[model samples]
Target: MAPVDRVDHNVLERTSLQTRLSEDTNTPEEQLKDIIQDLYQIMVQVSTYDSAGRSSREVLINEIKTLSESLRTLHTSASPPNNLPSVPPELLEYVEHGRNPDIYTREFVELVRRGNQLMRGKLNAFGTFRDILAENMTTAMPELRDDVVQVVEATGGVPPGRRNGEQSQSQPQQNGANSNHASSSAA
Candidate 1:
């Protein structure tokens, strides 16, 4: 088979597998909802048992039987698909504490975004420091100027004093220098 055809076939297979897995994951949740609805109906029938009279007893009994069957289906469906991801303990704990899981997810996402922003700030600070240090060291030791330039270019850093447009202009030079350095180093 052609390489392109093989890749398409593999992609189709993966899509099919994911579709099946998602359906499997939802099956138990759907079953549980069905069981809950059945219970609610049975409760309603029992509550109106006296008003419903003799016929109510038969309806209540039928509802109870349906509820029993739903419970059995739920029991069987509760076995999760083998490849399904397990619930995180922290999420389970949050729910057990009576908090909404959606709130927990939002809070967790916000926490991660804050952490990422903090780390990004740190990384920017370090990059700025690297550029300033490189500029100063180049001035202090003219003999090491070439090596400093190489390091700065290889790291895709903007040299001190280069701003927006100038920074963009330097990118191609930096990329070329970086690739050359990478190839030479590999050799």
Candidate 2:
């Protein structure tokens, strides 16, 4: 099979696994929650054992047995496949500290955006400096005018008055003028 096809197959397999895992675990999670609530109610009943009579005590025992069976089923069904990705340690630590994981995600994204903005600012500053220096150099040394223009063009700088598609038609005229200027300076 082609490399691209293999990669696509892998992605589809992983997505299918994840979807199956989600569907398989959801019911067990709900059952586990209900079991915990049932246990809590049983605990309250047991705590009032004296007032709860023999019939009530038997009912509590039956409920406990039912909950125990449910927990066993949940334990078996909720076991995740070994191929599943483990949770990130940082996210676990955040949750352990009682912080919301979404807040951590937001802060991380904000930090990355700020870093990108700083880099963009630096790039813009350098580009501006390049254009300004090229313009000044071309104007100050007319004898080296062609060389300066070549350097500016090669470095992706649009010379002054040459922006917006104006450079193409005027470039030959500029080259002729530069040659005349160089010849005059040499004489």
Candidate 3:
């Protein structure tokens, strides 16, 4: 593989360009969201592989599950990912309203660029255990992706990249009355 910086830069540039799509890029505003979303997912897969490696992703994932459960007990602390991202005001207003077209004509975007950069910066973190995600993702089973993502969470990297499906699935099920509240927590 190329140097980590090279790979990371590629991913970062891809994400930035995807997220900042405008008329000059010529992608219709309607399609921009999906395009950015797809780009985000690709970056996520790369990040998962880059950060977690291929060996211990599943075990690391289980560990994160345990940690997440424990975090619920830290009365004075808060789970990190649940906080709203400090997106640019233009983005936030659209997000606040569930993508109401009337509210933000340029349309909406999930703010994953910063998360990707953070994940890249921490790509070599947590020693060898971090490689687990990459190893796990190269295997069979759709669930492999989940395991890799959980491992990323365990390493205390940024929340799962939405493009990679990591950020979205981490949310607890909204099986009850407050389903809407459970919505944005994934991002």
On TM-score, the leading prediction is 1
RMSD of each: 19.4, 19.2, 33.5
Instruction: Report residue 130 deviation for candidate 1 (angstroms).
Output: 0.5
Instruction: Give the top-scoring candidate (lDDT).
Output: 1
The lDDT for every candidate, in the order shown, is 0.63, 0.61, 0.43
Off by over 4 Å in 3: 1-140, 163-187
Write one digit per residue (lDDT tens) for candidate 1, span 1-187.
2222112323433353344334444577786776686677666666557763776676666666666766666666676666578788899998899989998899889999999999999987787678767767855775786788788888888553243324443354444345444533553
State the lDDT of candidate 3 residue by residue for 84-153, as single tens digits: 6655676566777787654454333233666677787666454333443333342334466666657666
TM-score of each: 0.42, 0.38, 0.16
Over all chains combined, what TM-score does candidate 2 have?
Answer: 0.38
Ranking by lDDT: 1, 2, 3
TM-score of 3: 0.16
Clashing residue pair totals per candidate (backbone < 3 A): 0, 0, 15
Clashing pairs in 1: none
**What would the per-residue lDDT of candidate 2 be over residues 1-187, giving only the tens digit for each residue?**
2222112323433353343335444577676776686576466546545553665565556556656655665777775876479777788999999999998889889989999999999887776676656656656765666787787788777654353335453465455445444533553
